[model samples]
Target chain A: MPTDPKNPSGASTINGTDAVDSRRKPGAAEKSWEEKTLVPTLAKSPERASKFTTVSSYPIRRLYTPADLSGWDEDRDLGLPGEPPYTRGIHPTMYRTRLWTMRQFAGFGTAEDTNQRFRYLLAQGQTGLSVAFDLPTLMGYDSDHALSEGEVGKCGVAISSLADMEVLFDKIPIADVSTSMTINSPAAVIWAMYLAVAEKQGADWKKIAGTLQNDILKEYIAQKEYIYPPEPSMRLVIDTIEFGAKHTPKFNVISISGYHIREAGSTAIQELAFTLRDGIEYVDWALRRGMNIDEFAPRLSFFFNAHSDFFEEIAKYRAARRIWHKTMTERYGAKNARSWALRFHTQTAGCSLTAQQPYNNVVRTALQALAAVLGGTQSLHTNSLDEAWALPTEFAATLALRTQQIIAHESGVTNTVDPLGGSYFVEALTNEVEAGAWDYIRKIDALGGMVAAIERGYPQREIADAAYQYQMEVDRKEKIVVGVNDYFTKENPLDILQIDESVAHRQAERLAKLRAERSSDEVARRLDGLRIASQGKENLMPYIYDAVKAYATLGEICDAMKVAFGIYDEVAIT
Target chain B: MSEKRIRVLIAKPGLDGHDRGAKIIARALRDAGMEVIYTGLRQTPEMIASAAAQEDVDVIGLSILSGAHNTLGPRLMELLREKGMGDVCVVIGGIIPEADIPALKKVGIAEIFLPGTPTQAIVDFIRSRISAAPSKA
Candidate 1:
């Protein structure tokens, strides 16, 4: 018997041919395994094995062995954690020392409402806070702006001025708990606003720890929450990196994100590859500004998507750590050990949550959350069950928070470090994912890094293809989504949460009052100063901090600069 | 000679930045042989209505993950009517509570595709509606 060239497994590899490869006559005993099994296998015949392709459509073997990672070296490839080439895990003890940060993405409705959720989460043993800003805040508009209209507290918390920010963090000790702000384009301004509120609370900047998702490269590629074009955006990111290095020692200027890319329908491999490329672009920008790679790289954290494909997602994270470490030490000549380690925050896959059978999402989220712990994440945010339908209800959100808590305290998975490290299947998949990502990185380098590739729509096209292939598999009943395809239930009413539209109306009124009370002269002067600074080569943090101190509205601040910076209109794909 | 391919504009209107549904739909429409234009994140009703007229698209699908769908949907419809472009079939997609669907219908929405709906269903629905239109001749 000859092994099928395409079929790594004994199962015949189906490549759009037929149900099974019929070229060779099957022995009389071959069909016995399929017919006699207590449970029916997904694909009984070898020829129907294409369904096992990973999210990127890379064919997966049913089992993996040492032979799959034949070329891997222990010292050169999988070095000790907290060392260069950190494939095994980031820190030496990983979760054994301290479990990954259970940072739930909490924010919705008005500032006051979101504040309660934040306080509740922190009170329930949540170590860190991750802010989710409304569309108005994310898109650089204050709550009262006409353009803000019906969206103030629609998607996330509405922050208009320092008053809102002050109220949002009212009783919470910003100094003690680390925070992560998921803001990109207008990152500098929002960060400065946070800084202002912290100062008013008498919190020392040096003692406060948090992350601003200031990585603008990913915004251009996946999350279209960008305000200015690439050049100015990159400038702002570099400005943050520079400012953080000089002032806020504990602050991570940016969290280079693959989470958004994955959420934007990118494959796991594409997310890893494009995200690393985006990270490299940031380092390049900082280096060009004469900043040392080691100075800002340690705190250069990452955010990832923990999808339902348990093994694949785990492999993706492990590969991400290895690739970043290798690229930093070997390629960029990074001297610091921290510079080589790829610290990351993971969130359970938002796209994987099905609106049908809303409760099933809790199980999916728990499974993905477990994978993140085994995958060696430094921090994580678990998706609420009802989010696929709406902003999670208080009950559902508490369940989501408890999901992470149970995994951390009871699961025993966190008792050990990188529990899946030496597994044959996981290691093999890690190697496979790393190689796939490396191949893309090389191709992107050929196209002159992430920006040029983005301009050519390379990453977008690849993500589109992967997304399309995944949908096709789902349609063909190959990759069964329990609630969607396999389990057929008729008209089960899902308990969906509803945010009242009045939240936005009230937020808008608050913004109007805040604007009227602020000194008009101070706002005008700060805004004008920011505009003039935008024309020069000055670091934007100081300018943004000044504007935020003057209580300049988010929209007014963005508009003053959008005039000089000009709006970014993406060129249609060629 | 190249036939004029159906150019569609898929917009996320009125501060609803949750675009997983819209992005999937846009890609599906594009794959179904239509040139899709996606205006990413947090668009106002006026901006969307103006864009619909400016792009001169065959269809305008408003994707709202935010609960302001009731208010935002009506605002866009009113603006579209004011612009004399009410003929553009604006399909509402995302988590619209069953009770709110009628209110949307009252505001002149032709169709509403909820979260659980398949991508092919949308593609097929758009194709049939576009082909059956008498103005196409």
Candidate 2:
């Protein structure tokens, strides 16, 4: 048995001596059964497959028994709900008290167009709002910029400035909804615009709640919408964390995400390890900024990908909760119970959705979402069937939302908390997953942290290698993707949502009008103030708010910061 | 005279950073024993065309997941023609709607590979197509 460095006490050893004495000796009984019954059956009819594995390529054993968790202490490892280690669930009455928030990510074309979709989703019983900005908006470019050509509103909604943001939230009660914006490097500027909109709506800053997908470390590692270098980008994230802690106390300043990491083709272990390490990196930065751990740590939420592989995905979540609790309490010495809890939102894996037989994706999403629910996600997003082609159409998005509804209302899985908490397979798999993650965390720590590791292209290279290996597996028929590798059929293409070319023209015209009408002098002065603040040691939130309020475009504000903190060019490795 | 090895340039052109397909294709082509150069992310049509010319590659693979392929694909072909490098074999991939495929091909895209296409198929297509053309060298 390999020893775990994190469990230096050898407490996790599977010696079978620590097991309760009342039960039969599981190890010996298993061997006896294999020799007498199983061997004969196998001789008569051999096992079907050569090897069984999870989607991550981790081997799956035939059966798990008490021997698999020999030295395990149930109370120590799987704590009570709402208690330390949060191995079961965060709240005592998990989904019985409140069902997981069904927040389908929706954004495409202009802000007005997306606003209609947002209203439609809310009317259809969506509990929260999650915005997906288009490429131009995500990359901190205006709709009229040269680089923004043909990309104004293709992938998501185009929000160029405060004006667009206001329209996006028009007629919607911003103070009531918990909005989550998926923006990275330009997250600060976009968040400032959002706060400005809330302020214009006469909403109290402290009362408003939302989350910013402001984890820039993952941008360098996985999602590549990054605008600045690691150091400056981290400064912006920390600034938001510090600002949110003091002012917007109800808001999640950053959703330190493993969603993109998994979508970028990482194993479940890598996703959990890197995401938790990223949380550690942020806490380290915030502490370096002279903040207490309990102050901002409570609001630091997580986002994970709910891929296929029912047991592995569940084990991953359980391990994520345990590992985070241990890290916060043991490593950071966090005192508050809320600070130790790992609250996460999960999105069904988009990469797993198949283009051929797109309708099969509905079943795939239902299973993935069910796993997320059973694993105790606080919120969830189910990918639409047509997402492999384009941004989901209205009918598809509504159907995706209904998938969550069916799981919550019709599915009986939510009646109990941590329903699979103590299964022999689940418990053993959770421990194994946690051990694997700890090994990776130690490796990343040896590399000086995630930023240093990313700078050396460590995680990048690992993910690329895993991605290549998975493709090779699929190609060789070693692993089968239902619609792609097996069950092949000619596909009749479904009608996909298309962002009209006129979206670019309309956005450009709106931008031109905004530029012509707004005070360019005020914009320039606020941008200059922001540029100066970017150079200094001041938290950039206030300066960004000032620029955003002055009607400065996203590109203008990001440009001002870019002048101080130059652009980052990644060392692309394949 | 010794036969020249196939040279390919795999470029990610657009603001979006969905490079999983691009990098996989690049590695696949390289494993197929062809020389491959990846231009990383956020390259414009002009930059991709210029890189293809500068590298003197025979095949160019453009990966655009941002839905900007309709614009970037044609402009890239236009630039290649302007630079008298129109003989280059260009293929596009990633999240392309079926309705856009014929138009892209009309604009000189040799082929379009949507998601779920095996790397071997991409490799085979590039190999067969490039070998069929006369040596530019």
Candidate 3:
């Protein structure tokens, strides 16, 4: 076997093809052991199935030894935490310094109603705020718009104007707690409203810390909430990154998200590969926009999904960090260490939850949360048990928050950084995930980055195929999802929280009152200015900020921009 | 009688963006010898009712995850009635709180399918429901 003097694993090179080589081969002794000991045991009990594979379809071997990683270079591949490449972990101290932020996503009903929920969660020891906008707001429709009739304040909190934003953060200080808004399409406009609200709160823009899910690429590829076409949409994203880098240095302008992609039924490896590729695409665009790598890269954060696959999820995170480090340092020549680090927030998979035996979701979320913790996430949001049914009830959401607290305090996992870092299986799996992701990245690069690849429906088709394949497996009983295909039980559905029906009417009234009171002339002037700027090369942030300050509704501003930028018609792939 | 494929209009009303369930149902229906017209996401009740009429679909399936089902579901049923397309059997799915199910059914939502439901179950339900209806073709 090849040996390296420096590698802790006593292996050799960890770069290019050498790293892909298996370290040890089965000798006559192993063969005899398999035949004598393994074959007899298998004859009695037999393997549970003909084959075993991970959720991502990575075939599981009977055993992994030095043979599996014969040329693995520990130092080169798995470095110390907080070091270059960040394969082990991002921070040297990791959870020892502080646990990942327990940010529970909460938003429903009117702004005041959601504000109360936010306060309640904060009081219950939730660290940060994650705002889930209602359908009208998410789609950039006014509360009173014809299309938004039944959707106002339904799925999430409805914020149609700066007035609603002000109420949503009514007593909450903008400067103290970092907020993450799950908004896209009209992300620039929503972000401008947030800035206006912060200004109203008299908070320094530079001191505001938060993340905007301004990931338009993933929207097109997975989420299907896209408003503009690819080129102009990317331009809007770069504008925010440049603006955030210059002004709000503490804020992450674009949260390149794999959460929605995974929720849309992408395999773990696809989520990793496609998300990282999206991040790379953004960086390329920003670089081409005359921005330095280090200036904006540090502020760019990622959002990932922590699915049910324990090792697969953890390995995905580790692989993501390593791939990002290599790309930033070697590919982009990023000098800043922070630029090489891939800081990400993870949410336990909502799609993994089952409506039957809904309480099982709590257990599933705990395992997913543990995987995320071990994977060294910067932030986590454990999904509630009732999420599969509807918006989580208060009791369920509190229990979900308690899940994270238990992991942080009781689980004892936070005691060390990268506690499972040196495991042979984890290391081997990490390499496999990285190699798989690299293959996808190279394929995407050959197609001239994500935009071109998305136009050709590359990632979309891949996700759809994986989703269909998984469904087929589930249907055929090849996959045993508890309470789904196996251990089937017909139980009464659990009590789910229903959104108050009056929310839409109340929000519409609020919108009407605001519209009646606001200065019409000023709103018109700023909107005209915004429309003019949208037709030019000017950053849309300032113009959007101006229009938002004039108390223009989201739909009005988005409509004005639509006139200039036009809307995108999605090419249905599936 | 003319043999016609069961035309199902699967529209996601409101802006939940949770299309996995919708797409699964669409594909399943298509596989089960049905012409499934999926109108993508953020489709309004009006748009759905109009599409159901224009497409001459035999069934209208509304997949809504955004708790706006109580509002959107009834309104969509009403719109279909206004269009005199009451023959269009409406089915609702996705994340509907059980408490609201009675109200939804009262407003003419023929069926409700929650999560963890198999695609075959949905397909079977559509087939059984449509086969019972008198042929218009």
- Give the C-alpha miss distance for residue A178 in model 3, angstroms: 1.1
* Per-model DockQ: 0.42, 0.81, 0.58
- Output the number of the lDDT-best candidate: 2
Ranking by DockQ: 2, 3, 1
lDDT of 3 at A106: 90
Q: Per-residue alpha-carbon lDDT of model 3 for A1-574, expressed as tens digits?
A: 1222344231122111232334446567766776677666654654444445676666656565555666779899998999977988899999999889999999988999999999999999999999999878887889888877777777789899999998999999999999999998989999998998898889999999999999999988888887778888888999999999989999999899999999998988899999999999999999999999999999989999999889999999999999999999999999999999999999999989988898899999999999999999999999999888888889999999999999999999999889998788888888888888999999999999999999998998898878877787787777778999789777887777666658888888888899999999999999999889889988889988999998999999999988877888776655
After best superposition, candidate 3 residue A483: deviation in angstroms?
Answer: 1.5
Residues B1-137, candidate 1, lDDT per residue (tens digit)?
A: 77667768898877544455677788788877898988766677888889888988778888877667877899999999999988887888887777778889988898898766778888888877776764633
Weakest 10 consecutive residues, lDDT, candidate 1 chain A?
A13-22
Q: lDDT of each prediction vs. the true structure?
A: 0.80, 0.90, 0.87
Model 3, C-alpha of A128: deviation from truth (Å): 0.9
In terms of TM-score, which candidate is strongest? 2
Please write out the lDDT profile of model 1 over residues A304-353, one tens digit for every residue: 99998899999999899989988898879999888988989999988888
Per-residue error for A518 in candidate 2, Å, reads 1.3
Q: How well does model 1 score by local distance difference test?
A: 0.80
Q: Flag regions of model 1 displaced more than 4 Å.
A: A1-51, A572-574, B1-9, B15-20, B30-59, B83-88, B127-137
